[model samples]
Target: MSNRVVQGRMVTPGTLAELIEGSPVLETEDITDADRPCPECDGDVIEVGYMPSVTEFVTGYKCQDCDWSDDDRE
Candidate 1:
């Protein structure tokens, strides 16, 4: 994996060391992680999981004081 960080936040370190990586972090409706900031809204990037059959990955990311929608990775 690249040592690159998205926007500024780093990906989980040493997370890919294992042979069988965990399931892809599926994004649900929309959530924000208070610890991580959102790249689009600059808000928190909450870790929420979605169903395995979801068409796309969705994560909740509310701007501190803006109307930006969540981030969807299709």
Candidate 2:
């Protein structure tokens, strides 16, 4: 699905990417379950691919239980 429950609110791929990127993105892909867990909380992690700019595409990861998040840019 393109939408997921993040912490408590329902968020789309764009929103999820924003949570990781710390800003709005230009484009986004569907949200998916990551094959890993949160580092801090050991919670379920979700993945989303987004384009922050015209030339950059990033894969973002977010914990469903807490504020922990990450990106492929690292």
Which structure among the candidates has the greatest lDDT?
2
The sequence of per-residue lDDT tens digits that candidate 1 reaches over residues 1-74 is 32223344444322211101244443333222446665666653334334334474333333343334343455
Mark the 10 consecutive residues where model 2 has the least summed lDDT: 65-74
Cα-lDDT of candidate 1 = 0.36
Candidate 2 residue runs with Cα over 4 Å from true position: none
lDDT of each: 0.36, 0.93
